[model samples]
Structures are given as structure tokens and as C-alpha cells.
Target: MSSPSTQPFAMGGREFVAMMASLQALQALAIDAMLPALGVMSHDLGVDGSNERQLIIGIFLIASGLGSLFPGALADRFGRRPVLFVCVGGYVLFSLAAALAPTFGALLAMRACAGVLSSGMIVVSSATIRDRFSGDKMARTQSLVSVVFMIVPMAAPTLGLAVLELFGNWRWVFGIMAGLGAAVFVWAWLRLPETLHPEFRQKIDVRAIAGNMRIAFTTRSAIGYVFALALIQGALFGYINSSQQLVAEHFGAGDLFPLVFGAMAIAMAMANLTNSRIVMRFGARRVSHAAVIAYIILGATQLFFASGEDETIWQFIPIMTLNLCVMGFISANFSAIALQPFARIAGAAASLQVFLRMVIGSVLGALIGQAYDGSARPLAVALVAAGVGCLLLVMFSERGKLFRRLHGQVEQA
Candidate 1:
């Protein structure tokens, strides 16, 4: 089957990549950018709790995952642009609702709603790429998206910190999310054309839905890789939940915690830039397998350091930063691999894949947060468990295959 583009519109690979990257940017802008404000929100609402701090992160993801299922079913039925427009609109409304929430519970509920809407943005954005690209090109494009993802994250913490310092409150972060949501909605509404063709639309008949789901689940490589990628992402989320506590509380990172986070962000960005160049040449599997191996090695070292030592900031930074850098390659490449087998079912596949990625990752993030004991032990343990498991699964699923195996595969229909 041919990929999405026929004539290759004015915004082909580069524009598509940049635009898709905005979806990730919007997410980071929503969650991470709101973090510094969580304390203020809790204090303002008289919430007076510790978990409220992480609620800013967790609630958004929970809602996003729940919101993903329908858009997949709808996107191919109606067309991508419509779904994109609605999702972005949903994000804007919910972000504003969150900003205006009168009580802590109201704000939390709105945050959850925002996540639900945001998931549509995430799912459709990936589907847009599947419409236009496939195989190693798809992986490379995703790598560029990963780079944009990291760049936004690198700035988000510092930005949030600055806004909190100047404004002395958290609602401004939500205000920013509202503004961004509005701008992106306008940009996408104007620039993105309808990519799904009428002939390709799947009616929402039971038989059609069942047939699509069966096709998605029956694809061995795609299913295996999606679960594997989700497991890896769960590990990443664990780090996200624990990183600040680990750095600030355990390592005495103080206000410099953002700097530490920024350093790791830089490492992840470098890996993405490297993947963008080589993923096309080597294919995603060759790149991913190597990166997973590196991830396992790095994770094991971190686990060892935490096992016995009064570990200093110097010790943790090197190993944890290395692990995250390797993950940039693993995250996008594994996703590209997982989605490579179904063209007709690309939206369904991305939806399911993203759902599990969120569900599993959020759970792991919660688990790590629960295990928090004023130490880095929980983060290190979760990473080692999740990272090594991902490597083993990749080995088993592919039967020692890498990019060489893709010579005969679809990468996605």
C-alpha cells in the first residue's frame, strides 16, 4: 500500500515532523510547565497535602489515556483534520476550565479532563505521521519529534521556574497552556489538510470494529513491540516522578534540580538528533536494539550505585543521564517498530499503543512515587526492572533479529 501523501504537499517531511513535534511540545507545555504551580494551587485551594504536588503530573496522564480510544475509531471514519481540530479545541477548553477551577478538587477534575483531550492531540498527531510516512522514514521523523519533545522539556522546567519566581503562583502555567492550545488550534485548523480518503474510511459497524481490533491484535510484531515500548515508557515515567525528589531531597540539588533535569534533557536531545540521522540508514530495529542494550548497561550501573553507597550528585548524574539519553532512541524507534505493520489500522494501532503507553507509564510513575522514601532507591529499582525487561522482550520477540528482519516487513500498513 502507498503511504499518505500522493503529491507530497508543501509541508512534506520537514513540516510534518515539525508540526507533529508540536503535539509533544503541547503536552510538555501542559504538564511540566504546570509543576511549579502545583504547590501554589494546593496552597491556594487549602489542599495542604503532599500527593497534590504529583497530582499535577498524574491526573493529566490518566485523563489522556482514557480519551485516546475514540479518536482512533473516529479518525479513520471521518478524517484526521476534523479529529485534530476537535481535540485541540477540547484541550483549550479544559485548560481554561482548569485555570478557572474554584477548588482543588475542581482543578484536579479539570486536569483530568485536559489529559483526556490532550490524548487526542497525541494520538492524532502520531496518526498524521502514519498517514504521510512509513518504515525507517517514519522512525526518523519520530526521532525528530523526539528531539523537539526533549527541547521543549528542557525549557519547560526553567520556564516554569521563572514564571513561578516572577508571578509567584501556578495558575499562570495553566494560562500559558490555554494560550498555546488556542494558537496551535488555529495553526492546525488552517494548515493541515484532510489526509484520510473517503474510500479508506471505516464505518463504525460492530463487524468493522471487531475486524479492525482483531487485525491490530493479530499482528505479532506490532503487538509485541507496542507492549515492549509501553513497558520501557513505564520506566521513563518512574524517573519523571522521582527525579526531582531524588535530586533535590537525596542529592541536595536544591533549586539546581532544574539544571540537573536540563542536563538530562540535553542528553536525550542529543540521542534524538543522532537517531534522526541514523534511524533511516540503519532502520529502527538496528538502532533500537543497540540503544536498549546501552539502556540495560546504564540502568544496571545506576542500580549498582544505589545498592550500596552514599552516592553523590556526581555519581548519579553520569549514570542516570546516560540511561535517559539512550531512551530517546528506544522510545521513538520502538514506537515506529510497533506501528510498522498496519496501514489501514494505523490510527487504531497508534491509539491502542499510546493508551497502553500512558496506562503503564502512569502506573509505574505512581508506583515509584508511592515507593518514595526520601531516597533514590525506588527510582533506581524501577528503572532496572523496566529497562532490563524491555531488552529481554525485544530479544525474544524478534528472535535475535534487528533491522535485517525489516527487509520483509511493512513497518505498518
Candidate 2:
């Protein structure tokens, strides 16, 4: 393993915030950047149907998760900067391919490849932070990241809308993705320095890989964090998969779908805004624990009303907003908590977390989407079930406590 220097890469507060925001902006650019064009992509590629459009989003997530898994081990062995370069380069290439894909299968394949490549950026950014910070500092820094992360995606559809309006094609969205990937690549190449040192960099011995897998399992703290991340992420993925269809098809919102989507996203922004302030004071553990319970209760209530004669758009929007808000809070903190335990092997740990969240979440999202019965009942029930399962997983993994033992706050009591 690479021996990290005691000195962190020094940046002023604003610079650090900018770097973190860049990572989030990159991610937001990938997914939401394409959302406004989902309809156009479907028509151009001959997958011109409402349900089929989700395949575009679902497949990319599945691909990205799988892509990130290997980097964990690779990152521990090789170093951070090089892997980031490779991944960003791959993302740029594949984005171009996706923009130029001639058929439905080709587009799907490109999206999946692009997803896989992008995870490198995702995994490395988190692991890089882990290399230099831990505990309160980690949570606080991550809170800033979570806030920016929340905001970029919130703004993505608007970017896509403007682009789509100008170019009158979804391909332009991929062009933007490609352009951003290239710009970030150049910026990283010029500005980003390697954080991990040679001293602790591990060798790619098969034995070490097996050993880490064993460690991940035996380490209850790590597993608990991973499980919660996976479950909560699955719920979010389900919502993303179903949202455009639900708003337009069920609520008949038409072009105003983006407005509705943005309103709900604003709720998420509020939650992350709250998360930024709350995590440092209350700590990552307590807030994350409470948020899970809040999500479950909120989701169950929404499900109850949605299952009844609540066709009023008024009824749907506020309930959905609350559910998404809680999600925004839980996601970043749970990841920080899970990640706190595995800073030494952050790449592998992040890969495991990413894989479980993406692959499993994608599967669950597809399952729930298939159960869509014209009413919001399917999504509401799915959210509640996911939250309940996630909460239970966290409880069992913690052996009843919700706060992470990994940070050695078990005595906080």
C-alpha cells in the first residue's frame, strides 16, 4: 500500500470547494445532462417508447457500478492520479461514441461503457478525500461535497433543456458530456497532483485481494455502511427511473415535467444544505440514523395516501419532496461513515460500495418500474420497502446501533 505523506495537498477553502464541486459537476453532467433528451434519444434510436427510455439510464448505472469495483483494488495498488486519468480519458472517448452511436444497441452499449469509465472519477474522488481527511473533518468536507453534488444534478436538466432547444437533438447532450469530460481531463492533468505516496502502495498480489475481501466481511462496521448505502441508493435509483414517466404519464404535466422534477430536486438541495450544517454539529452517525427512520415514516405515509384517491397533483408533489429530501441527507453521510472505516483501502472499499449500490439498486429499480400500474402506488410502496430494508440492514450490521463504530464513536453514548 502507498504510504501517504502527512502533508495533504494544500488548497484554500474556496479551491478545495471548487475541486469537490467539479467532481459533483462531472457526475451531474453525465446523468441529468441527458434527461431532457431522453425522449429524443428514444425516437432517434428507434426505442421510441416511454418505458424504453429508462433503459438508457438504468443500463449506465449498472455499467458504472461494475466499472468502479475493480478500481478499489487497483487504486490501492497503483495510485490515485493515474487511475483518475485513465478513467476520465475513457469517459471522454465513450461519450463521443455514445453521441455517434448508430442504433439502439449501440447507444446502450456506449452509455454502459461511459458509465463504467465515469466511475473511476467517482471512486477516486472519494478515496482521494479519504487519503487526506477523516472523522469530523471528513464529514464536514463531505458535507460541502454533498451540497455541491446535490446542486449540480439539480441544475443539469436545465442545461440539457437549453442545449436541446438550441440543437434540437439529444446527440448534443452527449456532445456536452464529451466536452465536459475532456475539459475535466485537461484540468486534472494540469492541476491535480497524486495524493497517495509510494510507501503504502500495495502490490497486486492475488493473496492481498483475497485478504481484503475477507477483511471487508469480518469488519462489521464496513459491511453495515455498505449495506445501508446500497439499500438507500436503490430507492433513489427507483425514483429516478420512474419519475419522468410518472410526472408526464400519470400527472399529465407535459413540458412542465422539468419544472416538477426541478422542484423535487430543490427539496434534495434543501436537505443537503441542512446536511452540511447538521453533520458537523450532530455528527455523521446520529443524523444518518435519524434520517433513515424519517424516510421510512415519510415514505409509508406517502404510500398510504397515494394508494387512495389522491389524484390531486398537490397531494403528490409535497410527499415526494419530503421523501427525496430525506434521501439527500442519508446518502452522503452514510457514504462518509462507510468510507471512514476503509481509508486504507478506499479504492476497493469505494468499489464495493459503488458496486452494491449500482448493480443491486439498478435491479431493484427495474423490478419496481415493471410494477408500475398507472398509479403512483408502485413507486410509493417501493420507496417504503427500500427504506425499511435499509434501516433494518443498518441496525443488524451495527448490532442495533446506527452510528458507525468505525469512527470509534461507539463510546459516544
Candidate 3:
């Protein structure tokens, strides 16, 4: 494979960001596109209870976390492009299989497998970004990628509804996912260059991989930020897992579910766009730290006001939008901070970071989702707890220091 710097990029910045965003957005597409179909899936699959429908979403995340553990190492050993191709291929195959599933268990299994494969796309795309940029620039680039990525969530639910309406079945949704994956796969094959530097490539050895993993874990800031990111992601996932039920059942807004979810996604996207511009001046720590504190306050207020009464759609939507707006500031910055300490092990580090984030978030979010008791109280309480956890983790990561930006600390890949 050619060295990243020696080879001319097949695509420019706009196309690069778009391609990377699409790869990352695939996971969102898979999850969000199924939101409108959950009720149908529950009935068709014989899933009992309202809460169990969340498993269709939560299970994919859990499986993605587990499946993410190995992709980083593979990407490090082989190369980003090749590993990505394999992931996209597996994703396409499993997505197609999911469409043909005859039982609920079969569908869940297929979705889980597809999620595992999709984890590679997440890991490799992140590692690729790390290979090309670092520090505030990395955060900025990621925020830009997120700006594009959020489009998927904003449109996914409506797209799912449209597909269901057109095809008259939920199975066609998975077929759409498969087709989109195939298109991305071909685009990537033709345009995406290998970003891993030849010098940084490591052999696929158990001891070496273990040593690298130890390095990532032992690094104070990396692991601390990883866990913090996980907690915040847990809160986000909790919202996602319970959103359909919250809107459809609680508010009786079945047809309006997509608009509500899309509004929140738009809020997040706007925040990301703003972060991409301001992060360079304020620094990742300052921006994300402030956002987390605000998130805590909002969560607390949401829990306080939302207790003992049903929150009207107006009240709930604005509060949730503000809460998610805070997340837009947190996610990209935390990810960049967590990956700041490693270069040669970018792939491995990205994998471990994503694995921790996905698993912890999946489990914590699943708990909150399963605790759904016909109200948004559970979600509010869970968000506050997650915010507290994030604050603690961030404090530990910074060695009790807050908001102090280190000059000349940016890592160059």
C-alpha cells in the first residue's frame, strides 16, 4: 500500500468528509430507520410487552460493542481500506439476511451480526481521521463529520415510514439498508485511500496487541475520557431506545414521531456545526466541559419539573432538544481527547474506545429503556445520573483540574 502522504487523495476535503460521514452514518441509518417499524416488528415477531421492542435497537449496539474489539487490531495490521471493505461486505450480507428472517429471534441475530460488521466502519473511519489530523483540528474535522452524519438520524425515521408505506412491509427497510451499504462500499473502493502510515503498521501478534491495549488503558487521559464518553453515550442511547415508545405511547404522537425525533437530531446537528467553528478558539476541554455541566443542570431541571406530572409535548421537546444540544458538544471533543495519546496504535485505541463506549452505553441505556414505566421520568433520571458520571470521569481525567487548556499540547499524527 502507498504511504498516505505520498499518494494523492482520490477525493478532496468535501468528498472525504461526506464519505467518512456516510460510513459512520450507516449505523445510525440501521437503527433510526427501524424506529417507525418497531410496533409492527413487535407484533409480527411475537415480541411481548412494550419494553421488549427496544431490544431490537439495544441488541445491535451491544453486539457492535463486542464486535468492535477486533477491528482496530485488524486495521492496524492489515490496513484501513481492506478492513473497511470486509466490514461493509459483512454489513451488506447480514442486512440482506435480516430482511429474510422468519422469526424475531432470527431477525435480532441477523441485526446483531450486521451491527458487529458495521463496528469496523466506525472504528476504521475514526482511526483514519486520527491518522490525518489531531488536537482541535481533529475535533473540528470530527464535528464537521458529525454535522453530515446527523443528517441520517434527521431523515431516517421519515425514510423508514416512507419505505414502509411504499412497500407495505418493514422487511423492505433492511433491503434499503443493504442497497445503501453496497453503494458506499463501491464508492469507498474507488476513492478512499489508506491513511495508515507504513511505519506505524504493526504485525498481528497477541503480545504486541496486548501491550498496545495496556498502553491505551494505562494512559490517564485516554481511559478517563473513554469512560466519560461512554457515560454520555449511554444517556444518548437511552433516549434513542425509549424515544419511539415515549412519543407514540406517552404522548400519543404516533404519526408525529419522526418529526419529533428529527427535531432533536436537527438540534444536535446545529450544535455540531457550531462546534466545528468554535472549537479551535475555545479548545475541546473548555467547550465540552461547559456543555457537560449545562447538561447536568438541564437533566436535573428536567427531572424536577417532569416529576409527578405528564410533561406536555412543548415542554418535553425543548428540554430534550437543549439536553441533546449539549451532547453535540460533548461527543466529538471527548472522542478526540481520548484518542490524543496514541498514534501508532490509533486503530487499536479507536477500537478500545469505541468498544467501551458502545458496551457501557448499550448496557446503561438498555437498563433505562427496560425501566420505562409509561413516562419520561426514567429517561430524565438516567440522564442526570449519566451526567454525574461524566463529570466525575472528566475530573479524574484532568487530575482534578477543570477548564485549563494546555498550550502546545496538540498531538500531530
Model 2 misplaced stretches (Cα beyond 4 Å): 1-8, 403-413
Candidate 1 segments whose C-alpha is farther than 4 A from its true place: 5-8, 400-403, 410-413
**Candidate 3: worst 10 consecutive residues by lDDT?**
1-10
Q: Select the stronger candidate by TM-score from 1 and 2.
A: 1
User: lDDT per model, in order?
Assistant: 0.77, 0.76, 0.90
Residue-level lDDT of model 1, residues 1-413, one tens digit each, is 34554334676666667778887688777866765455567788887666546776787776777777778878878778788888888888888888788988898899888888888888888877777777887788888988877877787878888978888776677777888879878877777777665556788777886677677767777767777777777777766766666776678987887777887898999999999998878878888888878887888788788877587888889988888888888988888777777677777777887887888778777777767777677778877788777877776668766555376664433
Q: What TM-score does model 2 achieve against the real structure? A: 0.93
Each model's TM-score? 0.95, 0.93, 0.97
Clashing pairs in 3: none
lDDT of 2 at 209: 73
What clash pairs does model 2 have?
Answer: 1-200, 1-201, 1-202, 2-200, 2-201, 3-199, 3-200, 72-347, 72-348
Runs of candidate 3 exceeding 4 Å displacement: 1-6, 410-413
Best lDDT among the predictions, by candidate number? 3
- lDDT at 98, model 3: 96
Q: Kindly report which residue pairs in candidate 1 clash with one another.
A: 37-170, 63-116, 64-115, 340-411, 340-412, 341-411, 341-412, 342-412, 342-413, 343-413
How well does candidate 3 match the true structure, expressed as C-alpha RMSD? Answer: 1.9
Q: Kindly give the number of clashing pairs for every candidate.
A: 10, 9, 0
Candidate 3, 1-413: lDDT as tens digits: 11263256767888989999999999999999999999898898898778888989999999999889999999998889899999999999999999999999999999999999999999999999888887888899899999999999999999999998999999999999999999999999998888888888988999999988888878887688899989888888998999998877787887989988998899999999999999999999999999999999999988976696758777788898999999999999999889877877899999998999999999988998898888889999988999999999999989999897766663423
